[model samples]
Target: MDTQYTALARRFRPQTFSEVVGQERIAQTLRNAILENRVAHAYLFTGARGVGKTSMARIFAKALNCPNTKDGVPCNECEICRGISAGNDVDVSEIDGASNRGIDDIRSLRANVNVRSMRSKYKVYIIDEVHMLTKEAFNALLKTLEEPPPLVKFVFCTTEPNKVPDTILSRCQRFDFGTISTDNIEIRLSQLAEAEGFTVDQEALELVARRAAGSMRDSQSLFDQLLAFGAQHITAADVHRLLGTAPDQRLIDLIEAMIDRRRDAALSQFQVALNDGVQLEAFTDQLLNYFRDLMVAACGAEGVQLLSVGRDCLPKLQEQSRRWGLENVVAALQIFADTKGRMQRVTYGRALAELALVRLSLLADMERLDDLLSQLKAGNAVVASGTARPTSAPPPRLAASTSPVPAPSLPAQKKNERLTPPPAEVASGADSPVTGSRDPAPIEAAAPPPVIAFQPGLEAELHRLMLSRLTDMTGTHLAKVVSTAISGPNRLDFSFSASYDIGRKACERPEVQARLESLVKELTGQDVRIQFRTVVTEAPEAKPQPAQPTNSRRKVVESPEDPLVQEVAKTFGIERWLRQEVLAEVVEAPAGGDLPEE
Candidate 1:
C-alpha cells in the first residue's frame, strides 16, 4: 500500500502552452490567437495518442478562465485555473466521446451548451476520442459546432481526424500535433531523473525514448515503470530485459549472417533466440525495426540522422549498409514483413520465424535472369549463392582463365572451340596442331557463322534481311513499314510509328509476323517468335553531324568546300552554302601577314 504512487506522466503534465514538445509551431499560433482575442468558437485537436492533444485543450481553457492570466498563460495558483486543470470547474465540461456517443448524448450536450457559465466567461466543452460518435450523433452535433453560442467554446480531440465528418471538421479550427522526437524525449527524461534523484544511465534513457515512438506521455509512463522496478538505478541491460528484445550483439550477428549469406549460422542464431524464451512475435518486430534502421543507414549520411539509435549502434550499421544493395535490403524486409501475417495464422510462430530467416539468408540467390545471362556470356566463375567456394574452380573461360587454352564455357558444347580464337602458334602455323602441315587452314574464311544470341543487336541484321528478302517477296512498302526488329530468345519484336497505323495493323496480323519469323529462321537456322505493335514517339530533332572516328583503315571524308562535296551535300538537304562561304574567307586571306603593323 505504501509503494502506491501517481504516474509520472500525469504528475508532471504541462500546465502552460510553452511546455508542449515537438509542436511548438501549433502552440505559438494558438497562444498568439488567444492573446489577440481571435479564438474560434469550436476548435478540434487531432493527432496520435499521448501526443498532447488533450493536454493542449486543458491549457487553452486555463488560459482563458484563469483569474491571474498573464501574456495568455494560465496562472496555476488561481482558483479557476486549478479547477479547470483538475476537470472540476463548474463552467468547464470534459466529455469522453466513447462513453456517450449516441444521438441522445449529443442532444443532452446541445441543451447544456447554451446555459450560462457560472464561474468563467467561456464555458469550454472538451470531448476526448471525439471520432467515436455515431453517424447520427455527428450529424446532431454539426449544427452546434457550426454556430455555437458566443460564451460556449467547444474543443473536440481525437486520434483520428479522417473519421470525423468533413462538415463538422470544416466549422472548427483544427490543430494537428506531431510525435515527440527522441532527443526531446531524452532531454525531458534527463530533467525528470535529475529532479527525482534517479540514477538512470543515458543509454537507458535513449532506449526508453526510442521505445516511446514520439509520445511524451508514453515515454514518461515507461520512466515511471523503470523507477518502480529498479528503485535506484536503471541501465541499458535493464532496458533490454524490460523490453524483451534479443540482445544487441545477437541482432548484429544475425544481420551480419544474412548479409554474408551464412544461412546455417543465421538459422542457428535464430534457434538460440527461440530457446532463450524470446517471444517469436516480439523478436521479429525488433528485428524488423533493426532492418528499418539499416534501410535508413543504407541511404548514407542523410538517412543516418533518421535512425535515432544509440551511438554504439550506428558505425557498424553504416559499414554493413554499404555492402547491402537497395534491392537486397528491400527484399529482405518484404520477406520478414510477410512472415508477420503468416505467424498469426499458425500456433507455432517459431517455425514461421525460422522459415523467414532462412529465406533472408539465401536472398543473394535471387539474382535477376538478365544478370545471370550476362555472367554466362562473360565466362566468369558464377558462384552459386549460399554456398562456400569450391576447391576446384569452374570450367575455364575467357573472364576467369589464366592459360591461353580455350574455355569449356556455358554455351552449347559444339561451339566451344569455334567461339574461342586459335592460339598464336596455331594461327601462324608455327608448331601447328596438325602434323605435317605446311600451310594453315583458311581460318576466317572457313570459321562457322557467328552464333546469334537473339539480343537487341540482332535488330540491325533483321533490317538487312527485310531490305533484301521482304522487298523481293512483298515489295518496298512492306519492308519500309517494318522499321526495325529487336530479338530475344526465339523471339523478335517490332513496332510501327503512329503515323503508319495501316502498316502497323497489317504487320500485326498473324500471317505477316509468322512469315517474317519464317524468313529469319531460314537465314539463322533457328525458329524465332515474332512480335509487332504500334507506338508513338516525338520526332527526333535535327543534330549537327559529328566528325567521323579516325583510324588508318579508312580514307578522310571529302573537305566540306569541295565542289563535289557541295553538290552531294545539296542533294541531301545539307547547307553547302555555309561551308562555301567559310572556305572562301580562308582562301581570300593574304599569306604571311598584313604588312607587319608598320
Candidate 2:
C-alpha cells in the first residue's frame, strides 16, 4: 500500500492560538476573551489571504469547545481537539461560505442553530469567506446573528470585509489580520526546510518569502513546489528560474544603463533579460519596484529600515538613488507604471517595454521645472542633476558679436556732457514775436541719452530674446513683426505692415512693452524704450492724358471736293460725285429744256 502525501501547507496548519504565526495581537486578544469569559456570540476576522484569519477562527473555536482547555489553549491530545483540527468536529462546524452562500443554506444553518451541542460547552460555527454570502442569505442570518442561542457562537472570516453588510458587521466583534513580515515568513521557511531535511540557501528562502508578498500560506506553498525539484539542496538560481524573475544583478545592470542615459545599453540588457526567459510584464513590474526602492533610498537614512533589499544591496541602491535624483526617480516610476498597464493590453509587450526603457534612459538628462525654480529661489545656480556647473555661476549670457558694429565716427561725449532743450515758447515758432520783451526763461538742462556700443545683430538678438521670453498671444504677435531697428539711441522700434494693426496693438500691450524693455536691458545693459509702428507703401499716381481737339466730333458731308469722294470714284472706275440734278438738266434740255416731273 502506498502512503498518501500531505502538502506542507496542510501538514503545518496551526491548531492552537500559540502556534499561529504573525498574528500575536489577535491571538492574545482571543485568549484574554476566553480567560475573562467574555467571548462574544459572533466574531468577525478579516485580512488579506493567507494571513491566518481562518487559522485564528479554528483555534478560537477549539479553545472554546475543548474539554481540556488550558489558559484559552486547546489540548491537541483530546478527541474533540483532534476532531476540530481534522475539521471533523461535531460540536464545532467549519462552513465554506463560498460553496453554500444562498438563503436556503442560511435557512438550514439557522434551523440547526437552536439544537443543543452534542458534547461541548459551546457549539462554535465558523464560516470562512462570509462576505461571499448573498444579500438574502445575509438578511436571513441577521436575526440569528444579532440574537443567537446562548450555546451557539459564530465566527465569520473573510478577505474582503468591505463586501460584508454594515448590519452584519455591526453585530460582531471584528479583528483585522495584517500580513506577515518578510523576515517572519523567511524564518518560518527556514524552520520548515530544516525539519524536512532539505538543505536550502538563505537567499533562496528570502526570494520565496519576498515573492509571497506577506502571505504565509503562499510562501509555504511556494517552498513546497521548490521541494518538488527533487534536489536535496535548493539554491537562489533555482528559485529565480522557477519564478521567472531576473536576478538582482541583472536588474542593477539594466538600471545602471538607464541612469547613464545609455539607451542602447539598456535595450541590450532588456533583450538579455528576455533571452533569459524573463516575462516582460514581470520585468516591468520588477523595474517599477526597483524605482520604488530607489525612492526610499533617496529619502536618506530614515528609510533604510523600510527597504525590501538586504544590506548587501543597500550601498548600491543608495548610489543609484543619488545618481537618479528623487524627481527623475518619480518620473521613471510613472513611465514604467504606464508601460506596465500598456503591456497588459497588447500582444507585443516587448515594444512597450523597450519604449519604456528608452524613456527612462532619456530621463537622466531631464530636470524638473519645480526643482530648478526652487534652486533659483535659494540663490543657487540652476544646474541639471548630472551637470557640473558651479553653484555661484552667473546666468549664461547670449554670445555677443566679436566685432561690435563700430560706433559712429563722432566726437565721443564727455563724461559730464548735458543737453539743454530750447524753451517751449521759443521752440513753437521763432517767427512769433515775444509779447513781453522778457528774456526766455533759462532752459532747463536735461541728461544726455546714454550711448550704446551697438552690434549689427542687436535688434535681431533682442527680437530673439523677446520671442524666447514671451508665450502664446504675445509671441504670436511678435512673430508678425516685419523688421526691428534702433530708431533712437534709447528707443527700439518694431515695424509691421499696416494690415497687421491688431498684431501691432497686441505688441503695444504694457506687459509686452515691459518685456521688450527688460530684454533690451539684458542685451545692451542700458535702459531702452520700445516703440511699435506700422509701415504703409502707397501706389504711384496715374499721369493725365493730353486734351482732345475741339473739332474732332464734327460730321463730314460727301462732295466731289472731298478727298474721300475722289478716292471712292477712282476705285469704282466712274466720274467723281456724279450728281442727280446734272443728269436731269442734260436729259430735259434735249426734250424742250423742261423737266418732266416736279
Candidate 3:
C-alpha cells in the first residue's frame, strides 16, 4: 500500500539548525552557546506553537550528544545522530509532560539522570509541554535541575511560560521565539513547493502565509491542505474558496465603500459575503486587520513589513489611507472590535456585521484632527479679522427710541390661566385716540386675559422639562425627584420618587420651593402646586403629523443684527470712506460737459 501522503510540514521538518526557517537569531545563539561549551544544565524555550520550538529542542539534543562534534554541532553521518533522528537513541529521551505529569514520572527521571551514556558523551532529556507538570512533579524535578550531573542536560519546551513556576524558570536559561513574518513564511513555502515538484502561485503562497497568522507550523499545514486539494498547481481563487476568506478585490471594494460613505454599497457587499457563506466573525477580524494596515500606512510606517498582505496590496492600502485618516481608521477598528464581542452573543451574526459596516461608514465623515484644526483656525481668522459679515444695507428703524415706563401691577388669576402673549399691536402701547400726550400704558390693562386650553394629562411635559433643567444645574445628582400630575388647567402637581430623598428635602424647603415657584410663575404666568406623592401618570403619546397640513402664509420673521455683523459693517465704513475721499473717485461730469468753447 502506498504510504499516506505526508504533509509538507512533517515532510520538511528541519533536520539541522541551519535548515530551520526564520529563526536565525535563536539558532545562532544556541549554536554559539554550544561552541563556547557554556551550555546551561536546564534550557527553557518559549513561544507560540510551530515556530520551531520542538524541532530546535531535538536539534540541540543532537548537537549536544553527537559523537563527531568538532564545534558543537551534529554530524549527520554520526551513528548517535542517526539514532536520535530516528527516535531510537537510548541516551536521548523525549518525554511528553502532558501525559506523564505525576511525581512518580519525575522521580523516575531523576533516578535515570545519574546513568552514564552508553553511546554518546551526554544524555539529553526533552520535555514537551513542560507547563503541564504538576506542582509536585515540578518540585521533584527541581532538585535534579538545580544540580544535574555533568553528563546530563535538560530541555524544557512550553507555549506558555507564565504557567511554569518561577523556581523552575529560575533554574533554566530561557530563550524566547518570535513569530515569523509572512514574507519569510511565504519564501519557505515556495521552497517546499519547488522541492516537492508542485507549481504554486506566489499569491497562493501568500494566502497560506496569511492564514497561518505568524505560525510556521500553521502555514505549512495550510500549504499541505492546499496541495492535497489541488494535487498540483494552486491559484488565488482556490485558496480563498478553500479558506473561506473574502477575495482581495471584494475586501478592497468593501473598504472603498466604507471610505466613500456609501452605506448601500457596503451592505450589498456584506450581503454578497453572506450569500457566499463567509464566516461573519472571521470576516470582521480580517476587516479589522485590513484597517490596521491602512492606519499604519496613514502613519507612514512600514506597513508592508508589519502586514501579512501582498506587496501589490500596499498601493491600495496607501490610497485608502489618503481617504481615511488614522483616527477614522482607528475608530472603525474599535467599533468592529466591540461588535465582535457582541456578535458572539447574537444569533443574527450577519445583522451584526452589517450594523458594524454601517456604523463605520457613518463614522467615516468624522473630522480628523488636522482637518478640524484647520477649520477652527479658519473660523478664528474670520472672527479675528471680522470678515464674515454681510455687506447689505441695515434695516430701517422702527420709529424712534421711546422713554422707559414703569410696569403695572399684575392681576390675580386662577392657576389654570393660559400663558400666551397678547397681540403685538395691542401690546405696543400705540397712541391713544383722545390723549395728545404720550403717556405710559399700564401692563395689566394692556395685557389680554390668558386663555386656558386644558389637556387632561399633559402635565408630565412640564415635569420632564423641570427635571432636565435641574439635572443640568446639579450635575445629574438632584434631578431624580421630579414627578408630575395635572392638578388643574394650569397647575402641575410636582412630587419626588421615594428614592430621591434629597430632592424631597429640597422641594419641602421653603426657600427652594419659593425659588422654583417664582421661576414657574414668571415663565408661565400661573401658580404651580408643589406636592409629594407616590402616584405617577402615564406619559402622553406622540402625535403623528398630518399628511397634508395647511402651510402657513405668515410673513417671515427677521432676526436682529448680531454684534459681529455690526462690527464688520463699522470696519467696512472706514475703509469705504477712505476709498471714496482719498482714493480716486469719479464725480458726475458737470451736467453733460460744457459747450465747446464759445
All models, RMSD in angstroms: 26.2, 19.0, 33.0
C-alpha-based local distance difference test score of model 2: 0.77
Model 2 per-residue lDDT tens digits across residues 436-536: 21232233323322223334456675666566545567777988898888877688888988888899998788987897777567556678888999998
User: Highest lDDT among the candidates is held by which one?
Assistant: 2
Please give the TM-score that candidate 1 achieves against the real structure.
0.66
- TM-score-based ranking, best first? 1, 2, 3
Quickly count the clashes in candidate 1.
Answer: 0
TM-score of each predicted structure versus truth: 0.66, 0.65, 0.64
Q: How far is candidate 1 from the true structure (C-alpha RMSD, Å)?
A: 26.2
lDDT (Cα, tens digit) per residue for candidate 1, span 1-598: 5977778888788899888888888888888988899998989998889999999999999988887888888889988988988889999999999999999999999999889999788999999999999999999998888788988998999999999989988899989888888999999999899888988998899888988988999999988888877858889877766776666778889999988989889999888887886667768887887777778777765434444356688888878787776677777778888888788888978888888888876656564434544433433223334122333322222232223333223444342122232211112322221132223243332322223334554465445545455533343445545455554567776666688777767766787767877666655656878776777878899899999875555333336757755664465454534354444443333445332121
- Per-prediction backbone clash count: 0, 0, 1
lDDT, candidates in the order shown: 0.73, 0.77, 0.71
Question: What lDDT tens digits, residue by residue, belong to model 3 across residues 247-322?
Answer: 7778889989988988899899888896896766667778878877887888888635634367788888888888
* Positional deviation of residue 537's Cα in model 1 after best superposition, in angstroms: 44
**Segments in model 3 whose C-alpha atoms lie over 4 Å from true places:** 303-308, 365-598
